[model samples]
Target: MDTASGLTYAVLGTGALGGYYGACLQKAGLEVHYLLRSDFDLVQRQGLVIESPDGDFALPQVNAYRRSPDMPRCDVVIVALKTTQNHLLPDLLPPVVKDDGVVLVLQNGLGVEAEAAAIAGPERVLGGLCFLCSNKVGPGRIRHLDYKKISMGEYSAAGEAVGITDRMRRIAADFERADIPIELAEDLVLARWKKLMWNIPFNGLSVVLNATTQDMMANPDARSLAEALMEEVMKGAAAQGRAIAPEFVQTMLDHTAKMKPYRTSMKIDYDEKRPLEVEAMYGNPLRAAQAVGARLPQIQTLYQQLRFLDAQNRGL
Candidate 1:
């Protein structure tokens, strides 16, 4: 699967995060394939368009595949599917990643490495966290709101079996050339958890209150609830022996206050009447609290309310 010069990457989901990185890589002259669904007809007909505060980009000649089997085995595969759709990995990934290929997940929450390892093997699975705000405006268009850093690392202590470190560096170099900042981490679990610390509060509370991050931060009650939930998360992290600073929660809250008016994906899903990722994002943290013998009554309460609301909305 090794390329002659540049690397070959297959982006499994051409949503906001995946599409942004894929567009950048393709523009950098790297061989990149986008595994898209039938809904991407407009993208196939015209092009993949990205509108960012930085600039606007259109990738007209980028290779797009509708079927997995039609794709060539790649040196690396970047997975950006939603948590609810993670089960499709076994079916969608095997055809695009060779035995020696690496698979990096830019997903939210934890446990994605283990899930991906079940399909791609431990040696081929890498963990990544994206710190960007983007939304799919339409079939072929994505809007990048803010931030563009991608943090990635090997999932296993043994590192990548197929020279993944070098390949990762090369991928970062490609991103850098394309004006996207990419950071490599020695400990991916920390990166995942750190990002989770931000997502769990902002995403869950935003959906619960039906508000944007700015709205959540502006309300004293909601902001206090989010801070308490974060404290519980910090306790869970501490029980797992991960040293977390006490001011971390305040830092995230302060940062959110200054960010543009951005709504979380959970809020978007609720507005669209689509299923939410309450289990992986909120339920799992509460379960982690139980496992660590930590009490997170506030988050637990919010989780229960959201679960009930979800069921009521679904008529279950």
Candidate 2:
């Protein structure tokens, strides 16, 4: 909670999303500690390297810990791991979060807040959505394709629980000072759904077609399919009483066009034979549609096809 002296931050994943933000914070002169499995030695020896379209950076002083015993308590902890790794969090998070510390769930898709809260406690959980397009090109190296703003807010209904404490405000200020666009929102649910609306179509289609965002958008049939899926998602959102403007979907597609040649994390996972986040990004929304009695035939078809593709890609 000491804003003036800078806050202690623990980055849990140390992958593309986590590493980029952590490096930015370190550049801003904040104290940052990263928890890793075995790459601590590599990062320690060669430093954390971030390659962006703007340029590249190497943080030589990046601190890393291979185990909980080596991690110090921090004021804030960023959870940037894959949703499939949620089970590991109960054991991985406690050592880094002080009783009063905040743990920010920066993963993609919905339901992470509830899952993180169940483990870290609602009072200590915050939700964050990163807009950057990035990937872990290799151990100790992260490639940032797009540098979008970061949106954060309280995970609990109380609006200023463990996640959006005064300390988070200070951290956001520091991020802004470091030239990282950061926004604080009271209605994080809306923010989350807004991000989801973009992900369900783009993430799913990219993986299914084995293409980048631009590639998907370039094909007329693929672009139409994406638009159809987005319409279904919008209907589902409306049923939830969170109607998104039609223009919003257009804007998202436009944004992706500008971010051409970039691949989504789900696509990367599929290529690397890692477990895809299809459930969180695609399944959860379909469930919500059913819950709200919203019919989405097109999305249902796309989801089924994508699931099959995902299964084949993972040999599951």
RMSD of each: 3.3, 2.9
Please name the candidate that would achieve the greatest lDDT relative to the true structure. Answer: 2
lDDT for model 1: 0.79
- Candidate lDDT scores, in order, read 0.79, 0.80
Pairs of colliding residues, candidate 2: 123-162
lDDT of 2 at 53: 75
Off by over 4 Å in 1: 1-5, 157-167
The runs of at least 3 residues in candidate 2 whose Cα sits more than 4 Å from the true structure, single-residue gaps closed, are: 1-5, 53-55, 157-168
TM-score of each: 0.91, 0.90
lDDT of 1 by residue, 1-316 (tens): 3333466889989998899888877876788888889546777778799999988989877688888789999988989888778888889988999777889888777666677888888877787788888898888788988898988878874322233377678667767877788888767756666777778788878877889888888889988888887887787666655657888887898888888888898788778777777877777766765786877787788788888877777778
Give the per-residue lDDT of model 2 (tens digit) for 206-275: 8877788889888999888888888887888777677689998889888878875877777778888888
Backbone clashes counted, model 1: 0
lDDT of 1 at 106: 83
